[model samples]
Target: NLGDALAAETGFKIEMIPLPMKRMGPELISGNISFICYTLEAWLPSVKEQVLWSDVIFNNQNLLVSLGAKPITSLKDLDKKRVGVVVNFYYPNLEDSFNKYQIFRENGPNNESNLQKLLHGRVDYVVLSSLEYQYQKKLQPRLNAYDLGIDTFGVKCAVSKKSPLSVSKINQAIAAMKKSGKLDRIFRLP
Candidate 1:
């Protein structure tokens, strides 16, 4: 979707190279990748020397979700329970908050394996995006889901410093797309 949007806006033949999110920072720094779509917190520190944030594409709220015979309503309820999370800047904050609730358990990086751990009772709950939860539920109907209200954060496209000109054009195109409601339309497309 992003490749199509970038191509249509910039008139450039954009080719997307899919890589695991964990490897994106190093790739960007080494000039192996031009840009990356990721959370602001994760991209900020890694790109301090050679990259700058271009524009925000979406805002996502992370949820602490649980599945099983019991329902979770508050952070305190997660005490001594295993929680799954993606490795990112937000993990520290999550860890601090969980510590306050006396919730200490295994923490694993986000991946299919970690998700499987949660699904199979290896972890007590998983912290992830609400969209991810909904999508996963469709794949596994027996699992219960709960939303633990949390901070909302922005998702953005980061550009390497070597491509300042490209960033300018991309930002301009993004602004136009927003003004024309093209971005909203594209995102809502089924």
Candidate 2:
């Protein structure tokens, strides 16, 4: 939907590709993809060195969720607890505490799997993106969640260093969308 909005606003044709997170960087560097969207700069240090990043398109909220019956209100509560985390993803401010407190991390292939672990009582809590958590709750209303508000970070699109598209152009369209409230409307943001 953002791509569609950007194209409409800028009069530029956009091609959207949905690829596994790990493959996005390789494909971008190889010139197989023009740009990859919805990525965090923190998660792509190497990719940042290789590509041009547009201004933030949106913010991704990183949350620590647990069943409402046993809400995890603070990071200190996770001491020696099992945390379900997505494979290859980084926690913004919790890694050091994990080691110092003996917090056990259970790797899940994706958000859904981590969510499942929490639902089944396999893990004390799971870290998930707020967007993913909302979508899952829509599918299964039984899951109760409490927000940890661990961190919030900007999400940007990465373009090939040699691509014809200018980061400024993309940023312009994104700015227009934000100004017109098109992004908030499309994403149902507050």
RMSD of 1: 3.2
lDDT of the structure predicted as candidate 2: 0.78
**Per-residue lDDT of model 2, residues 1-190, tens digit only:** 7778877987878888777667877888888887766776677666768888989977878777777646667777777889898776778687777657668888888888888788889998788777777777787786666566677888888888766677788888889999999988877765
lDDT of 1: 0.67
Number of the top-ranking candidate, with TM-score as the measure: 2
In model 2, residue pairs whose N, Cα or C atoms come closer than 3 Å (at least 3 residues apart or on different chains), thus clashing, are none
Model 1 TM-score relative to the real fold = 0.78
RMSD after CA superposition, every candidate: 3.2, 2.3
Where's the lowest-lDDT run of ten residues in candidate 2? 63-72
